[model samples]
Target: MTRSEATASTTGTPEADEYDVIVIGAGPVGENVAERAHANGLSAVVVETELVGGECSYWACMPSKALLRPMAALADARRVEGASQAVRGSLDADAVLARRTAFTSDWQDGGQVDWLDSVAVDLRRGRARLDGPRRVKIEAPDGSTHTLTARHAVAVCTGSRAALPDLPGIEEARPWTSREATASKEVPGRLAVVGGGVVGAEMAVAWRALGAEVTMLVRGERLLPRMEPFAGELVAEALTEAGAEVRTGVSVESLRRPSTDRPVTLALSDGGQLEADEVLFATGRRPRTEDLGLETVGCEPGSWLTVDDTCRVKDVHGGWLYAVGDANGRALLTHQGKYQARIAGAAIGARAAGVPLLETDRWGAHAATADHEAVPQVVFTDPEAASVGLTAEDAERRGLRVRAVDLEMGEVAGAALYADGYRGRARMVVDLDREVLVGVTFVGPGVSELLHSATVAVAGEVPVERLWHAVPSYPTISEVWLRLLETYRG
Candidate 1:
């Protein structure tokens, strides 16, 4: 039978409104899972209460990048002598906000919904909860409810939400989460950003460029604490150079805003107080499983779902439940979540067809081994920070005998030509026992595009001798590879 015919035969049947796969959440991860299942001749339906494209499309990735790009472009131009002469004015905050809104399609999901229809993946606009094994109860926006049974699997991809601290008067103060930070139409004259992770650092760069006096108050000693120490140090130095305040080793004791018209007063942990027109609490994220009725399936509500490499939930019986993306807590990155979705969808399809899951081993078609070994990320600050796989500290902690090679990016002909006074660093950690790179980090302008090559090297575990044969074109930042190799040899 044709694919559509096969899907039609199994979906919305008269006996019971059932599908081969009932995917909870219509985010990118959930969408990929449903699409893959449908491609494998299984009928799939995705349920989402919010926008179909989810956080990345609206609040996190798309809008955030849209806001950051203009500033980065201007900075790039300022680094070049002739271009710097032409760049005269500050960023137009209104124009930047308009561009950001345009990227989000003004917060509408009609296009995403249309795409789902085109792919033959049914979409149910509602909040969904686990009824039991292979069963889901959906409550529609209009208050109607229905239960759908999954013939093969039910995958939860309901991402995460910003975790606000339990500070007194926080709710009344009305702090901004990532969503508000990215979506706000107006730039506050004075903005206080809490936390120093990717969201905190990037938003600080974005708003500060848009005419806000940005002050980053980090509880930790540095920004981007998860990456190499130098990465955070570089970002903090840049933020300070750009006139934003980077205050580390500080915490908010309490927050108070007497009225909507007034400013927020933050009582600091060091017995000091500061005020800001707006405060963004980019603290952390919490899973969206509290109301998903996980208790019905013997899983604790509001807890991260434990999943194997195949993205199958471990605690649930029958092997019919799957959780991908941030829900699984494997890797919170959007790309990594999509990767897990593809693997999980294939595993579900194979099991439904009574086929043996032969590719369940490491680095196999059904396994998400990259989550543990070669996750790649790029922080899009002024000088982008990109890294893949293990950091040197991570490799050492894992008991791997590794030698780290560091190189000044300015020494590269390409980097020098890319910008005047180009300041950046590159590092590669090699597994001495294996003679392969276990980690690679690049901190410089336009380094985001250089990440995939490192991702391939780490994921492929290509031998150092073979990498030497893969020549880098001269006068490019990629030539840093050759320099790193030379440094390693010396």
Candidate 2:
């Protein structure tokens, strides 16, 4: 059968179909929007060109964590005296690669397809673009087209892509984006990573542990410039200790690779050249809005869509258009994207049912309050760094009356017991005027699990006095919370 005919029989014909909500992109954000809209009695359909699970499920988060977990486990084993003696060999690369493949479901989308089916969200496999307000045009793989109309709202959840710098020969070099890095079958002998952000830092740690001679080129003074300075410092120290050559205050002038099989040669801003088996440019991300046909709806084609408290597109006349997740350019993390999806989906349902949006406050159900008040993220590195809300520097720049309470996490008995020589730091940015934590950061082995407590505190805006009653359990890494609180009180 023809592609159009098949689509009509399987997913319903464009002329005969209309949904209350149409979500572009079937990633976690898109999936959540469809699921939540369904929960509110709205008929929703999700259009996707790739795997429904998106980057996190296939390439970015799941695969990367699967690769990092073994390395972390081995490191901890080596740190303890009794376990250190039992360790005698390096990581099994083949086994590690196999586990990573399993975690990503071998890059298949079947599981995610089943999830959408269970949630009663219609799935259309196509590249979707905004044909006009509340109208989406989708191009199928076989060069057929389908038009979908949204009765209530069209949500942009297409997320973002890895951004490469403008440089000659870089594109032809076939450099490793985050996709290739995490899902790589063969480890590069020498890897050059440019950019000091989360991707750069995490990949540097992962590849170096997996036996790649990683050279990190950071244009800034340190890695993770977005986080607190101490967080970056500790990460740099860990990367250096892992035998990765960490270079700061450097830039790539040009790149040259005559063929895909050839090593990539880089000409540095310092008038030096280095060659590597692979080069990953994890500089940043750009919204996947280039081909969304935003111009037809009176929105800029390649720019981010502005959204209000309800995630409703600001400039659209009838407010039928909304943008969520990385496409909104608010918080780029997956969890934050899911949070926005919940808010945007509910808002669409409310509008469809002719119900008023009652609670639009900072922590309200109809508004993505967590995106502004408390966005939590955990960087999976040895001595993992997890943080939520603002850093001290961010609070100062925002002109908020905040005080930073910094302490060594090693002083906590739980941390010391967790590892023979626990080396890490903790910091809390307290809103002195409100007597509550505005931000919190923890960097140490096994510290990623300790982050949600801080997330709850910041999101709930729990007062300092009330927090004192919420005692952390004795003899756990979470005791850092108690230490931070005590330091603040003093």
Candidate 3:
């Protein structure tokens, strides 16, 4: 009679034993795909090796952001309570790790399995490997083998895995990647970061704030090369202020164990070397598509499965297979992966149910999407940096009419009130022809919270004129938006 009652299905119970759709990798995207498929009246089963929620829920974004969030919360507390005794304290490593463990459900898979059962999506606990078209072979933890045949389609949502660089003895170093780095309990006395990308920069700041002497060896010119130059400059300033020694335009020549008790020494391409108790290789990641029996499916080694604009995995023999998320290399982000999964799920359901699926020329339901146009990104370092869409340099290379506006963040009222000695920058790129917001970069303390506002404006294609009307509150860091618009007009 009610929506809740209607959703309460037999599929969740053991009564609904067989499933029409079997999803490999029960990460967030996998769950999303399963849910979407279920909504389309197909029985869905989600197989997961670990927790149901995946990396963002436990290790990657959640834990990293959790460690960084205390600083943010403390800032808020200090701002609200001038007396300071109301929230007088520092981080307790044990307590934080305990909380993280609780959030991750303590590496136990039963709760997630129960959730899948309640949601009417079958939960299979196993390491899933793709066997062939519309098929998966799973090795359950209980020493049992099972096979699942997906009649509709198979969706791959295996998130990316850490990639170690080719440095002599680097592999032998037994260093921490994002997995160990984010889930670490104790902060090392000295930490050396090997990459300059998002994870490296963010973790460097987080650990440094937690009292680790951090030095970042980046092979790029700026801290976050993916952001605007102005934004990157602000992030670099933030890292330096927090006492992080960032050396750019350098590569790792060699890594070696100095002693059994001491830290490792990393030799650089610039004929310099540094030692730290901990070494983190955040160079990059590749799709976790290896050993999934893709060879049996005839997929290439070098590249990911070839999926169409609709997320239909292409092949010479046939075109029934599909891949999404990190496996597609479309966007190795949780949200983007989930977005692709939704499209793939909907497409499969529509085709199976013989419904004429509505298609769009660009972003909308039923498109693989996220190619072309803008995708928002944020680096959660102190004096944070956030950006969406193409920078002026990228736009020029792509042959777009771009007009850029740059301003020191200190010029805004928000920056002044944020702190007496504020340090950061704000920049925006506008499409001169379309008069729409293309990209925005906000850098400075307490600015990571401001990203979604700009993201909404850009994704909605809010015109610069309309954006001007969308007023940011006064005496807040967001007032930088007004200053930016004024600069653009002038």
Candidate 4:
């Protein structure tokens, strides 16, 4: 059925209300689950206490991108002075924070209610914990308590939270997490990011743009170790050029206060310490499965709830009870979680309808889909890194016969206009036997917009020859696609 037709219709009086599905979270992934379930003729209810858009809408991606966009535009303004006046170099910090507050609707959460109304899905304002299989207990804001038993299935899409590593004096200090970083209206004078991962780098650039001195400390030798070495190199370059210092190959030995008026100091193993106005722990995130009633449902005790190909939170007995999104500890990104939620939602709906349940597979739309294929990741810094598919090392590890090509991106016409002396990198990994684009990476200013072409080609398994026919628009940053393809021929 078309999405429009899935808008729920009134079926009964207020006294008699029941649903086919009770989704435990109203995050983006959970919202999608409700829509997909409703589309399959199963009544659904989404329970959430926080803003309905969850962490992504309120904190993570939306606000981060909002901040990063101006950084990119400012870089553009420096070149074209006429437009610079219109573009404005000085980001009214207060104005931008006002805009961010407006984006979250001033924390009023009315926008999310409108979305649920538009889709005709029911929303419950409360925190949900599992009571049993297919049972949920909700604790509401007004000190009211309620319980629900689903007629069909219970799907958990509760996302993750920032994990504070076992660092000495970390919790006592209460260093800024993503919550504080995203919500803070005032930029710290000196900021030290504890992890060199995606969150650390993104925040490092963002704070730097706001006129804050920033430093990034990474345990790994390079940034974005999940990506190819070349992509990591370009990100390191951009961070350094942005007036932030990047220190790699050093573990933070300890963190504590250097003085009463001073910021927290990170003592390094190399006998050096850097003082910062605030320390942000972006080391990683752990699944928020605590008090989730996984034990009542016969799942494991750890934060992670293991799910199979179809995203069923397979119990300790290796049976079916699925967890999707960050709760599953697989992919933490908002989009990927929504992608997996769709599969879990569909599988549950179809199975109960007495139809054959579809098994999840690499290319199958019913699976987590990105599990076996290109999972696109973009860090929305000024000089962004958008990467998908396998790396050269990943290709070789899988024992695939692969040929790799790397090209400096400034050679392209797109890069010339992107920045005066554009210093981006584009690399492609080709599966020799398959003759298809197995992987793609693009790093530089104005490159995030160029990522989808590569994602489409890689996920569609389009051959390099067919990709040649898929011409990128002229004078756009995407022409780097064509440039990299030409280098493959050379």
Which one wins on TM-score? 1
Per-residue alpha-carbon lDDT of model 3 for 1-490, expressed as tens digits?
Answer: 3221232234533443335677878888888888888988887877777777787777788788877776656645555435355876666666666676676666665665565666667667778887777778889887787777776777777777888877788767888899888888788999999888899988897888778899999898887777787766766776887688988899889889956677899888999889899999998888877867777778865366667767777763555567777778777777778778888888879887987767845776788555545677778877678877778888888787989888888788777777656767777888899998777888877887788888787777888988789788887888888888898889
Model 3 stretches astray by more than 4 angstroms: 1-18, 75-91, 258-260, 316-318
CA RMSD per model (angstroms):
2.4, 2.2, 3.9, 3.6
**Model 3 weakest 10-residue run by lDDT:** 1-10
Q: Model 1 RMSD to the real structure?
A: 2.4
Candidate 4, 163-255: lDDT as tens digits? 887878775566899888878889889998988888888888888888889988888999888888876777778779878899998878788
Worst 10 residues of 4 by lDDT: 3-12
lDDT of 1 by residue, 1-490 (tens): 3323222333556644688899999989999999999888898998889998999999999999999999999999999999999999999999999999999999998888878777888887788999989889989888989888998999999999999999999999999999999999999999999999999999999999999999999999999988888999998999999999999999999999999999999999988888999999999999999999999999999989999989999978899999999998889999999999899989998999999999988899999999999999999998999999999999999999999999889999999999999999999999999999999999989999999999999999999989999899988889999999999888
Off by over 4 Å in 1: 1-12
lDDT winner between candidates 3 and 4: 4
> How do the candidates rank by lDDT, highest first?
1, 2, 4, 3
Q: Which candidate has the highest lDDT of all?
A: 1
Q: Give all TM-scores, in the order shown.
A: 0.98, 0.97, 0.90, 0.92
For model 4 the local lDDT of residue 238 reads: 76
Candidate 3 achieves a global lDDT of 0.77
